[model samples]
Target chain A: MKGMTIIVKTITRWVKLFIFLFGIYVTLTGHLSPGGGFAGGVILACSFILLTLAYGKEYALSRLSLKTAKSLDSIGALIFLLTALIGMWVTNVFFDNVLQKLFPGTDFMLYSSGFIPLYNIGICLKVGAPLFVTFIVMAAMRIRINDKGEREIIQEEEEE
Target chain B: MFITEIYLLVLLVFMIIAAIIAVEIKSLISSVISLGAVGVGMSISFLFLAAPDLAIVQIAVEVLLLIFLIRATLGREIVSEKGAVTIPLRLLSIFIVLVILGFGIIAFRNLPEFGKPVFSLVPEAPSNSYIQHGLKETGSANIITAVILDYRGYDTLGEATVLFTSLLGALVILRAKTKKNGTKVINHKETKARGGE
Candidate 1:
C-alpha cells in the first residue's frame, strides 16, 4: 500500500513527535498520574502506527526494522526481570521495593517512586515494540479464503 | 447526585444503542465502527465514574482494536460460508441469551451497593490494607500504581510475562515465508542459517 494522501502525511509528520512525548510523559509520571506502563506503551505504539498509516509500510520498517523491534522486545523483558532479581537480592524477597529501603525518595516527585518508573520504562519498551511489530506483521500479510474454503496466506513483496 | 445519575443514564443508553447498531449492521466495516463507538462510550462513562485510569486504557485499546478490525475487513474479499440460520436454531440461541441475561441480572442484584465493596465485609482484607498504607508505604501518589508495581509486584510481573509470551507466539506463527524450488518454506530460518538468502 502507498499510504494515505499528502494532507494526512503532513499532519502525521507534525503530530508524531507530540504523541511520542505524551507516551513518555504518561510512562514517566505513572506514579503521580493515572496512566502507567501499559497505557503509555500503547500510546507510543500508536505514534509509529500513525506514521505507517500515513507514510506507508516501507517507511515505518526503515525507521524501526522488524529485527530491531524484536531485540528491543527481548531487552525490555530482561530489564524488567533484572529489576525484580535485584530487588530479591537486596531484600531477600522477590519484587521488593529495594530502593525504598536503601533511600526513601521524597513523594510526588518524578524520581520519588522506588523502581516504579524503571518498571514503567521497561514495560513501555516491552509493550510498545511488540505492538508495533504486530501491526507491521499483520499489515504485511495478505490472507484470503478461496472458493473451495481453503485459507491462502500471501506475503507482500518488499520495496527495493 | 441526581445529575450524576442522569449523566450515567445517558451514557449507558448511548452505549446500548451503539452496541445494538454494532450487532445489527449489515456491513462488516460499519459494524466494526459502531463497536468502536460502544468502546468510546464506555470510556467516557468510565471518566464520568471517576476512573480516569480505566478511561485512558480503554480509549487507547479501543483505537488499536478498531485499527486491527478495519485492517481485517477493509478492501478484503470476504466470503460468507455459513448458510442462513434455521428458525429453531435462532430461537434456541435467543433463548440461551435471555437465560444468560436473566442470570446476570440476578447476580447484579446480589452485588453490594455502589462504592461499598463486598471486601468491606472482611475488615482484614488486603485491599483495605493497600488503601490505608499504599501511598505511605510506596511513596507513590497513585495508590493503584503503588498496589500494582509494589504491593502486588508479582502479579504485574506475571502479566508482563504473559503479554511477552503471547506476542512472541504471534510473531513466530506469522513469520514470513518464501518459495524455494516451487515449495513454501519459512524465510526466517533460512536468513539466520545462511546469513541471507
Candidate 2:
C-alpha cells in the first residue's frame, strides 16, 4: 500500500514534526498544565497514525518497527514500576514523593514536581507506542482471495 | 454568563441529536462521524464547565478513537442482513428509557443546584485540603495532577498495568504461532505455497 497523494505527503512532512514536538511538550508539562501523560500520549500516537495514513504502513513501519514498539511498551511500564519501587526503597513507602530536596527551589518550573513528571513520561511512552502498534496491526489485516475463490482473513505478521 | 449558559444549552441539544444519529445511522462511517461530533460537543461543554483538562483530554482521545474507527471500517463493505426487531423488545427498551428518565428527574430535583454541593454528605471533603496542600505536599501546581500522581499513585499504576495487559493480550491473540522441526508449526502457514505471503 503506497501513500495517499503527493500533496498530503508534502504537508505531512512539514506538520508531523510540530505535532510530535507538541506531544513532548504536553507530556513534560503534565504537572503544570491541562495536557498530561494520557492526553499527550494520544497526541503522539495521532502523529504516527497520521504518518501511516499519509505515507502508508510500510513507511511508518520502517520508521518504528513492531519489535521496537513492543520493547518501548515494556520499557515504559518497567520505568514506571521501577520509579515506584525506588520511592519505596528510599522512603519505605510505595510511590512516595521521595525527592524532597528537588521540590522547593524550582517551584512551577519544568522539573518542579518530584515524581509526577517522570510518571507522566512513562505513561506517555506506554500509551503512545501501543496505540500506534494497535493501529498498524489493524491496518495490516487483509482479505485474500485464493485460487478456489474462497475468501480468508490474511494477517501477515510484520517481519523484523 | 447568561449567554454562556444559553450556548451550553444549545450545545447539549446538539449533542443529544448527534448521539441519536450516531446510534441510528445505517452507514458505519456516518455513524462514526456523528459520534465524533458528539465528542466535540462534549469537549466544548467541558470547556464551558471550566475544566480545560477534561476538554483537552476528551478532544484528543476523541480524535484517536475516530481515526481507529475509520481505519477499522474503511475497506470492509457492510453485509446488511436486516433482522426484524420484535415489538416487545422495542417496547421494553422504550419502557426502560422512560423509567430511567423519571428517576433521573426525581434525583435531579433532590440534588443541590449547580455549583452548590450538599455539605451534609462528606462534611468538608478533601477537595479544599487537596488544593491548599497539594503544592507544598506534592510540589505540583496543578491540583488534579497532584491528586492523581501523588495521592492516588497506586490507582494510576493499576490503570497502566491494565493497559499493558490489554495490549499484550491483543498481540498474543492476533499473532500466528509457528512450529519448528519434524511435522510443522501449530499455527503457521495456511497453504504450503503462501507460507511467507
Candidate 3:
C-alpha cells in the first residue's frame, strides 16, 4: 500500500513538473502567442489540482499551505502596485515607461523592455497562488459520502 | 464563405445550442456545464472579433464562476425532476426570445464588415507613440499586451483587482471555519487527537 502511494505521488509530481514548465513557457511566450499571465496561471493551478487529485488534499496542503499561498498573493499584488507607482514618479503617470533610461536608443532586446516582464511575473504569482489556494480549500471542504450516507470532511482525517 | 466567416457562423450556432441546453436541462450541474459551453462559444466569438484578451478573461472567469457556483450548490440539490414547461412560462420565454432576437438582428446589421480597417471619424486622435513604445519598451511582442499593460494601465489594474476580489470571495465562502464552541466538527477525530488530546 505504501509503495503504491509512493508511485502515485511520483507520477503526480512529474505531471505537476510538466505543467509548471509548460506554464513558464506560456508566460514567456505570452507577448507573442495566445497564452499570457492568465493562461499560464490557470495551467499552473491545474498542476496543483492534479497533485491534490492524485494524493488527496493533505499531501498537497503539506507541500503548499494556505498561509504561504496567501502571502504570495499579497506580495504579488504589492509588487504590481509598486511597479505602477514607480512609473508614476518617473514619467508622471502610473505604469509609464520608466525603463527607457535603462536601455537608451530604441533597444528592442527582450530584456530591454522595462516592467513588462516584472508585471508578467507578478501576475503569474498573483493568479497562480490564489487559484491553487481556492482549489485546495474547495477540495478540502468536499464532503465525501460513504455507503452509509455519511458526510465526512477529509481534512479532519489529517489531524488523526 | 471564407474560413473566418464559417468559423464565426459555427460558433454562433454552437452558442445558440448551448443556450438552449442551458434552458432545457433539468439538472443544475448540466445547466451549469451548458452555460460554460455558452461561455466558451462566446469567447471563441470574441477571438473571431479580434479580442483575445477579452476571450481569455471571459474563459477564466467562466471557469472560476462555474466551480464556485457548483461548490455552493453541491448540498442543495434541485428537488424537481418533472422537467415540465408551463404554458405561461413558455409564452413569457418566447416573448423574451423574440425581443432579444429582434435586437440582435438590428445589431448584426449595424456591425462593420470583417477585416475592414476601422476608419476614425475624429481628426485629433491620440498619438500611436504609446502603442509603439509599448511594443519596444515592454519586450512583449503581442500588441494586445502593449495596449493592456501600457496604453491602458489603470484598466489592467482594475481587472487585477476584480480577479483578486473574486478569489477573496471564493475563499471566504468556501473556507471551513471552526465552530464557536471550539470543537472540531469534521470526521475521524479519534485518530487525529490521539497523541495530544
Better of 1 and 2 by lDDT: 1
TM-scores of all models?
A: 0.65, 0.66, 0.60
Residue pairs with colliding backbones in model 2 are: B179-B185
Encode model 3's per-residue lDDT on B1-197: one tens digit a residue.
38989999999999999999999989987888899899999998899888898999999999898988777767766555777789998999999999999999999887767764234332343444544465555555676766676677788778788878988997665445644433234543543565522
Ranking by lDDT: 1, 2, 3
- Residue-level lDDT of model 1, residues B61-82, one tens digit each, is 9999999998898866656689
Off by over 4 Å in 2: A101-103, A142-153, B1-99, B117-121, B178-197
RMSD, every candidate, angstroms: 14.4, 14.1, 12.1
Error of 3 at A93 (Å): 2.5
Give residue A44's error in model 2 in angstroms: 0.9
- Candidate 3: list runs displaced more than 4 Å: A1-13, A101-108, A142-154, A157-160, B1-102, B117-139, B173-184, B187-197
Per-residue error at A72 for model 1, in Å? 1.2
Model 2, DockQ value? 0.30
Q: How displaced is residue B102 in candidate 2, in Å?
A: 3.3
> How many clashes show up per model?
0, 1, 4
- Which residue pairs collide, candidate 3? A31-B142, A159-B192, A160-B191, A160-B192
